[model samples]
Structures are given as C-alpha cells and as structure tokens.
Target: MTQTPVSKAPVFGAPPRPASDVSAAVGLAGLAGLMVWVAICRAWPEIGAALNLPGPRERLAGSSAAVLALVFSGTPMVLWSLLVDKVHLRPSTGIDWSAPRPLRAVTDGAMTKLAGLWATWGLIAFVYCLARWYWRGPYVFAMDLLEQAAPLLFLGAIPYVLWLDRVLVEPRDGAWHFGAMLIGREAYDREQVWHHLRAWSVKGFFCAFMISILPGGFGAVVEADWSRLGADPVAWSNAAISAMFMIDVQIAMVGYLLTMKPLDAQIRTANPFLAGWVAALICYPPFVLMGGGGVLDYHQNTAEWTYWLAGHPALLWLWGGIMVVLTGIYAWATVAFGLRFSNLTWRGVVTNGPYAWTRHPAYLSKNLFWWLATLPFLVTTHSLVDAVRNTVILGIVSGVYFWRAKTEERHLLAADPKYRAYHAWMGENGPVTRRLAALENALVGRRRGAGEGVVREGGAGEESGQGDRHPAQ
Candidate 1:
C-alpha cells in the first residue's frame, strides 16, 4: 500500500520591516563631523605652528579643548539635518514652517515654556549642587564646564524658545503643559508634566557623565603613540579600543546635548517604569554596583586576556583582534543611534547597523568583550573557589545588562507601535534572535510531546482497568 505523502511545514514569514527612526544620512553626517574634529585635534600642533597662532605648541588635548570639540561635531550634524535631511519639515517635529504664527500670538506660550524650561534647569542645577559626587574627580570637570556655560545657555534659551514657538504647529508640548500646571492658569495633563520631568532628568544625569568621561578617551585617542603600538598586538588593540570608545562617547555626548525638536531628535518619552530607572541607574555613576569594591565586582583574582595569553604571539594577536571587533560592534551600535542615544529614553527606534542583527547589540557585544577580555573563570589566584565566584559574579553582571535590555524593550513597546513591529520582525528575522526563537520552539515542542505521551499512557491504563471491571456487564 502506498502511503500518503507528508506535507512540509510552512516556512516562517517575518513581519514587515519597520523604517529606522533615524536616517542613515543623519548618522553619516554626524560621523563626518566627528572625523573632521579628530583630524583637526590630532594635527593641531603643526597647524598652530604653521599659522603662527598664539597658543601652546602642542596638540590641544586639554579638557577645555575636548569640550570645544562638541561644537565641531554638533554643528555639522545640525546643519546637515536641517539643510540636507530637512528634518524640521517632518510631521513628527510638530512644526509647520510654511505657516509661522505671528510673534504676538506665540509669545505667551513661549514665555510659559521658558518658565518651565528655566525651572527644570534650576532644579537640575540644585540637584547637581546637592550631589557630592558632582564635585569630585571627573565630575569636577563637568561641573566647571557647566558652570561656565550656564549664563550663555540661559540667554540662548530665550531666542531658541521664541523662534521655535513661532513655527511649532502645537506649541503646547510637555514643557508647555508643565508650565501651565505650575502657573495654575490653564488645565494640564499631569502625565505630560511627569514625562517632561523624566526626559530632562535623563538628559541632566547622562549629559554630565558623558561630558566627564569625554576628555579621558579623547586625550587617549588624540595622543596615542601609533608608532610604538603597531609592533605590539595588545597595545594596538588597546589603542583601537580606546579610539572606538572615544567615538562612542563623542557621539553619545552630542546626542544628549542636541535634543532639539527641529532635528527630530527629542526624547519622545523617558522610560516611566521604576524598574527601568533602577536597571539603568545602577549601571551609571554614583549608583554603579559593578565597579571595584562594589557588591557586584567581578574582577577579583582575575587576570586579563593579555596575561593569560602571554608568550603566545599567535593567540595574543587572535584574541586582541577579537576584542577589537567586539568593541567596534559596541561603538557601531551607539553610532547607529546618531543623535538619539540616551539611557532609559525612547528617542527613536533604530533598526540599522548592528541593531539589524540583534536588538541589544551594544549590550551583547559589550558583555562578550568583558567575558573574553577578563577571562574571569581563569583567575590569577589559581583557586577554583575564586574562579567560580568571579565567573558567577560576571555572569550576574551580564544578567544585569539583560535586565536593562528587557526594561528598555518594555518602555519602547509601550511608547511606539513602530518598535512593536520592529520587535516582531527581529524575533522572526534577526540573525541571533531567529536562531534563539527556533531553539525555544524546539524545546517547547519536545516538552509538549513528552506531556502528551504521559497523558495517553494514563488514559490507556484507565480504559484497560474499566474494561477489566466491566467484563461481565
């Protein structure tokens, strides 16, 4: 007898791919600006001498100069977004440039917004004053810089608000709602006010951290001894890694600072969940739980890849190359954000570059690099207990990142439908996610089959017992 042919399972079809919130051109523009600034910084000494400029005859690698680099990097991005991308014309910007409101009509709204904006800044400044950490170490540099620029920023806000209001289609944004509540002259959504506060809190907290760390990486990259590094794989890798971090920091700093509606780079919503706040804050500054001596410190008794791989030239080279690649992926993930990168905030949905492969490319690459480079399981102490403890601690640290990824996803899923679509697409089509999904399905299928077998056997036993008891009936 011929058996009926079995039908093949239908192929998995991915959901429609969502458009990346930030355009490729915008990222390229920012990258171009960053490269220009790097070139200028690296050659500044020679350029200064050639021009007979009255400054130090050395590369401008000071914190002040590094701070100034923000201008070089940010200006081009802004110009390109406005002139090339025409981002201001987008409906998402909440602007109607063609029908600008009369100055008198927008003045009252602008003034109220200014009040809210100023109050928010004042509150942030007060918090900065209260936080003792802001006065110490790297944060001192940030404090100094912000202190110097406070007056200018205050003055600049006036014209910026006034000009923006004239073109804004709906001038009553979160900030306006906040101002209305404070003034008590108009009705306002409490949720909108809270959103406004959360957005600024993210900016306030992250901008300082980004600015504080900028000079360290910027100087390392600017002053790296390329000639000496080429001969040593470890040194070369370190330099490359530092340069990548410098790029990430520079781009991220620009992102935090340039949260303008016109560029369509404003924070759409900060993560409202407390769990998200905890997950993100614990990774940063004063609250970081993974730093040395902290509860989650995983570096105890550990030797880096360099030490363990020592004396093996081939292995060292291969390992160093791997580390550099991981770091590059992490940096690329940040760059893909362009001006939208910020912690616990949904500026936009990024579905390009490293993100196209995995939803948490930065965290994945970063955690992998840490594991590979630290080699926590191979401790310097040579004690199994130490090795196990270190390994477990590092695993916990990785778990924290996973927690962060989930929290971020939770925020984005609720905030934007585009992100929901992107999430679905990633689950089906993403290189890493698709394989994970398939494995999960396989495991689940096996479990269901085992459960069914148990049920069938139990039912069969019940039938056999009943048949035996009813044999006479």
Candidate 2:
C-alpha cells in the first residue's frame, strides 16, 4: 500500500494579526510607560513646591516614576482580568454584540486601546511641552502633558475598545446566543481557529512595525524646544509630527493584524510564526535598540523624522512593485514546491512563495517593508544611504538564508526525491543569485573562448533577408 503525504504550503502568507492580539500586550506595556511619564510630570510641580526638588525628593521622585512605569507596564491586565471575573462575564467562545450588558464590558478592551493610543499620542505632545518647559514658557508640570494629549486620549478610546474586543471575544461555543442577534460568533472548525490564531501572531506584525519605529522614536529624542512649544508655528508642527507617528504605528499594527500568520502558537516544531518571531526578535531589537526612541540618550525629533521618511517612497515603489507582481507567482511557487518536494524535514530554507525568484524573498520583503514604512517618520536625504546599509545587511542575512535554504532542501530531498528534482529544476531555471556565481562567471568569461573566430550570421555579417540555414527560409 502507498502512503499519502501532506503538504503544509496550503497556507503560506498568514492572516493579518487581529487588532486585538497585536495591540493588547504592547498597549498594556505602553500604557504603563505613558502613565508613569504622566504621573511624574503631573506630580513634579507639587512635589517641588513642597520640598526642594533638587535634593533627596528629586531622587525619590525619579524612583517613584520608574516604579510607576513598571507597574503600569506590567500589571493592568491582571487587575482588569480580576475585575472582569468579578463582573461575572461568561467564558465566551464568541462575541456579545448586544451592548456588553453594562458600560464596564465595553470599557475593558476600549479603555485599553484608548489608553494605549492616548499614551503614545500624549508622548508626542510631551515633545512640545518639554520644549516649552525648557524655554520657560509656562508648560510646567505633568498637567500640561495631560492637557495637550487629552483630546487624543479621549477620542482615541473610540477605535481601540470597539475594534479590539470584537476580534477577541469568542462565542461561548462558536455562537453568541444573544437576544435576537448573533454577535462575533460563528461556527468554527478547529483547523480554521488554529489557522486564525497562527495568522494573528505577534511576529507577523512586529517585523514591519519595529522597522519603522526608529524614525518616530528618533523624533521623540529631541530636547524639547520649550520656547517653540508655547509658540504657534512650532507647536502645530510638533502636533503634526505626533499625529503622523500615531498614524504610522496604527498602520503597522493594522497591517500585522490583517496579514502574515504563523503555523501554530506553541513555538514548537509545527509553528512557522514562532520561528518568524524568534528570527525577528533576534534581528529587530538590536537594530532598534541602537536606533531612535529605544535609546536612553535621545529620541527622534522633527528633523530626524523628516530625515528618515525621505527614503520610503522610493523603496515602496521598488519593493511594493515586486511584491504585487510576484505574489501570484509566489502562490503558484508555494504550492508547487510544497507539493513536489513531498516532505519538509529540511532546515529553515523557505523556498516557497517569492522564494523561487530569489532565495530570500522574506529577507528582502522584510527590509523593504521596514524601510518603506519607516520613511514617513524620517524624511531625509540619507534614505538612499540607509537603503544601501540595509542592502548590506541583506547580504549578510542572505548567508544565513542560504545555509537555511540549503539545509531545508536537503531535508526535503532526503524525505522525497521529487523535491530534489524540483530543487534542481529551479536551480537550472536560473536563480538570479548575487553571490559567488557572478564572480565565478566573470572569471570564467575572461578565459573561455576569448578569441573565437566563429562566423557571423543574419544582420551581423550575412544578407538581411536570409535565414541562418538557406533552405530553412
């Protein structure tokens, strides 16, 4: 009897991260950071008034600020969950669309997104406030920060809570049996549900979002132009930059929310997303840590933001064009390689999708999207230079990709002979690689048939109307 084999390439490009999953953890941490910033700023004046702030009180204040940050960043979910159960919401498998029973129901997810959004936007306002405070223009304490960010904080709540909860709520059993209406509940098969969970994983979103943050973060690094903050022209400019940053973050989040899923959640052998995230976590933090807002020393300012954004439009044109044209091609290739290969015991050589065009479509797209998304935040002349740098990095990463791809192919080939054949066919079709082949070809060209005396045919040395073989005409 013959055994039937399964191919996993049926779903290559994962679903976008649902808004809920992507934002929840990050928003929680961000909220904590912002709240701490707010509390410190708010309390500074009063604390200073009570005691000489330059003395022990200042140190105490800083310590308190750090502590507040830690708490706000870490524990809000625990509190929310504790109270959530106290409110007696059922362990649902679907959405409850009929007015969350009480405002508190709406408040949970809504407040979280709103708070997170506000905190981020508020950080933008803080730039101006910091500037004003430095210039001695009366933007003194934390209240100033709140006042500046208040509108955003309030308005932001609308999108965050409404959208995220909808994504997260599971119907008690795949059908929210509400009063005359079925809410975010639909029948779900285990396979589809698992697919969804995998699709919405953090790795899908983090790759793009992290890449772009440097520019925005850099914009936040400038010492507040205190005088300009209180003034009209600069104040508005600052606000605009803040708004832009907010838009970018959300854009990145949404992109992840909607596309790029993983194979599973357990970070085990079966999951592709965990691997993607693990790869991203390794590559991303170091670059970002050395970049704009992640640094302890300074954040990105308008100039920095302007500078970074300059590179994006061109990159978007180049890579976006490639992806658009290649994605369909990628689909065919993903399926073909997946099936013909007949097995996947290989190492991390992802030869599906656009990988057929080039060995490292994932690497290329990752950098392309990262730089493209980052361009809006920092519109600068250095965009090309930065691209060049990224290209260099790609060269290095390609080495790893090569090793991984090779290992994976070997594994597949070992498991199934058809995979080995397909691999060779692809190699024969000319994988336009940029590495050793070029130099080797060049070296070969300089020596091989250097002075061939072959007869010319057709237009070069023969009659214009003639075919190469006289009788063939």
Candidate 3:
C-alpha cells in the first residue's frame, strides 16, 4: 500500500497570508499607542488626577495629556508606515508604487492619526462643558443623561477614529498594501475597502455605545427584587420589557462584530436618497435634541389606548407581548443581516430570516410597534384640527419609513446583482407580495365579470340590427 503524504504546515513567520498588511499594521500601531498611554496613566497617578479635576486647571492639564497621548500613539504608526514603505514595499511587485513614495505622503497620514489620538480627549472636553452648563442651567436632568452617555461615546470613538483615519487617506506608496483579502475572495479594491472600513467604523461606534449602556440596564434588573413584582405589575412589566430591549441591543452589537466572516464583503450599498437621509436624521440625536423645530419627535406623540389598557391584566399582557414580538423581529432582522447590517450603505444581500418574508422587516415591525404604542388615531386633542394634525404627523413618519424601504431597495438593486435576483424572488415569494397579488387578482376577476355582462348586452343589440336588415335570416 502506498503511504499517504503529509501536508507541510505553514511556517510561523510567513508574511500573514498576504492579507491587507496596511490595515493590520495600522490596527496594531493604534493598539500599541493606546496600551502605552494606559500604562503611563497607571504608572503616574498625578497626571490622571490632574486631568480629571474641574475648571481651567483641569482643562489645561487635559490638553497636556492629550498632546502626550498623541505623541505616544502617533510614533508607532509613523515608524511602521516608514518601515513598510522602505523595506517591504518593492518596485516591481504587489501594490502599485512604481517609484519611491515622497516623504509628504507619510506626514499627511499622521493628520488622521493625530485626530484619532485626540478623539477621546475631545469628547471628554465636550462632556465637561455640557455638564457644567446643562447641569446648572434650566435642564438640570440633562446632566444625568450626560453621565450615562459620555463614557460610552468617548471610549467608543477611540477605535472608531483610528479605523476611520486609516481609510480616509490611502497611501498606496506606503509599505502597507491598499488591497485587502476579505471574506476569502479576490483582493478588494482600495476604494471598496475604504468604503467598507468607513461604514463599519461608524457603525461600530454606535454598536459600542449600545453595548456600553447595557450594564446600566443589567444593574437595574439585578437590583430589582422579585417579591416587589406583584405589588405593581405594570411597573415590573415595563422594567422587564426594558431589560429585553437591552438584551436585543447586546445581541445586535455582538452580531455586527461576529458575522463579518468569509470576509463580510457581501453587498455594498449605493447612495441613498436625500429625503430618506433627512427623515432618518430627525429621529436620532442632535436633531432630536433641537426640540419642536426638529422634523418630528416621537416623544411628542403621547400614548393613547395601549397605555390605558395597561391597567387590565389580559390587555396588558397582549400589549406587552406585541411589543416584545416586534422588538424580537427587529433584532431578528439585524441577526439575519449578520455582519452586513449597516444603515445608509449596502453591505450585502441578506435574504434569509425575516428578510425572506418582507424586504424591510426591521423597519416594518418597528414602525408597526411605534404606531401601536402611540395609537395616534385614539390620541386626545384639544380640537378636531389638533387631532387631524397629530394623525397627519404620524402618517408622515410612516411615509418616511415606506420611502426608506423603497430607497434601500433601489440602492441594493443597483449595487448588488445578488440583491436584484433576491428582489425578484422576494416579489414572487414573499408573503406580503403574494397576498397583494391575490387581492389584485380578485379585483381583476370581478371587473372582468362586469365587463362581460356589458359586452353581451351590446352584442344582442348588434345582432337585432343585423336581423332587421336581413329579415328572417
């Protein structure tokens, strides 16, 4: 019998599969800088304490700390980019530098590098300013929101900016190659990689923020005693629902981070419509913070029938169940998207899970939940005009979501051929689409029956005329 040949294992130091070296090196450098900064802060308690103190002295100390952080972070990246460009990058081969790259390119790369280093300190300064003013000002409660949100945003922005900067400027001449081997496919074009990185970096920040806030919810749930549950079921139910919402948020964050396998490069989105963008912006922060002048605020739409029904146990359960189901569906859509889930850009064509049923399952379910929760139809109003106005506003919000769905499809169809195929399949196979087709068919059949009767009557008249002309014939 012939002996089976054993395959040789890859050598330990073999250039890392020639994946996106630039991305890898940049990432490593960023981490190194952060580690160094953290170590310095740990070793020197005076610097940390000075930075945290209140007022002008603290601000000056923070600025000095930020400069040090930049120095610590920026050095590794500059050196690595230099080493790779000079040593690893060759004239004849892999990435596209025919001649030696100028020193200017490397210096330009440092701008974003500096920006990333300063992101955390910048956030800290902003929060301090906001807290100092807002806490002492009329909106005293805003301070509480600040404390809960600031740390999440600050910590998240550090990595977000680091990746963001790496993508912002493409130094093809540098030792780091622009092309990245993603999802085990061909090397991604520099542009594609840039877009993918930008989208994810921003998306990651949002996900991180969501993940960070989860601990507050966990703490609340943990501290809650079950013995107190029966005393006020509505409050307990609300608390439980809130807890589940946080869990859904955590699932989404993890799914976004993990599902980027096989290179996560499935679909890329086309440019979205301006109206859709505007509508989406109004629903989120900064714009939402602007108060009534902002496009539309969900808080303005007070709850109606559902909140009232909370007093009754059976109705309350039904309402709570519906909300929970809707939340689960939203989360399910995110999970279905896996690593492809991002707003504004197309990541890939996701056709499984809730997507198989309807094209915009998350948006559909979410809007439905909102409508149910708000029940604009049953909302109390001072006047009939007010009632109509409230209903119209709610309708506009629904219309915005509908337009968002249409625009997303348009983007996906143009960008991903797979999405185009999926769109066709969904039209034919989706549950909602099938139901709409059946309804249309019924309407057409009834119209055809009515038309046939009219035709028969007209035919009799024509035959009588012909018989009159031909007598007995």
Give lDDT tens digits, candidate 3, residues 268-382: 3324456545645555444442245455543354565456685688777677678768776775555444223446665545544555556667777777777777666554444
Give the count of colliding residue pairs in each prediction. Answer: 0, 48, 7
In order, the Cα lDDT scores of the candidates are 0.77, 0.33, 0.45
Order by TM-score, highest first: 1, 3, 2
In terms of lDDT, model 2 sits at 0.33
The TM-score values for the models, in the order shown, are: 0.89, 0.27, 0.51
Runs in model 1 with CA error above 4 Å? 1-16, 439-473
User: Candidate 1, which ten residues in sequence have the lowest lDDT sum?
Assistant: 464-473
Clash count in backbone of candidate 1: 0
The per-prediction CA RMSD against the true structure, in angstroms, equals 11.9, 21.4, 18.7
lDDT of 1 by residue, 294-383 (tens): 999989988799999999989999999999999998888877777777778877777767666677778878889999999998987799
- The 10-residue segment of model 2 with minimum total lDDT is 464-473
- For candidate 3, give the lDDT: 0.45
> Residue 329 in model 3: shift from native, Å?
1.5
Q: Which candidate is the best by TM-score?
A: 1
Alpha carbon lDDT at 195, candidate 3 = 50
Q: Tens digit of lDDT per residue, candidate 2, span 114-222?
A: 4434444444455545543322322233333335546774676476446535534431211112211212333335543343333323322242233234233323422
Alpha-carbon shift of residue 34 in model 1 (angstroms): 1.7
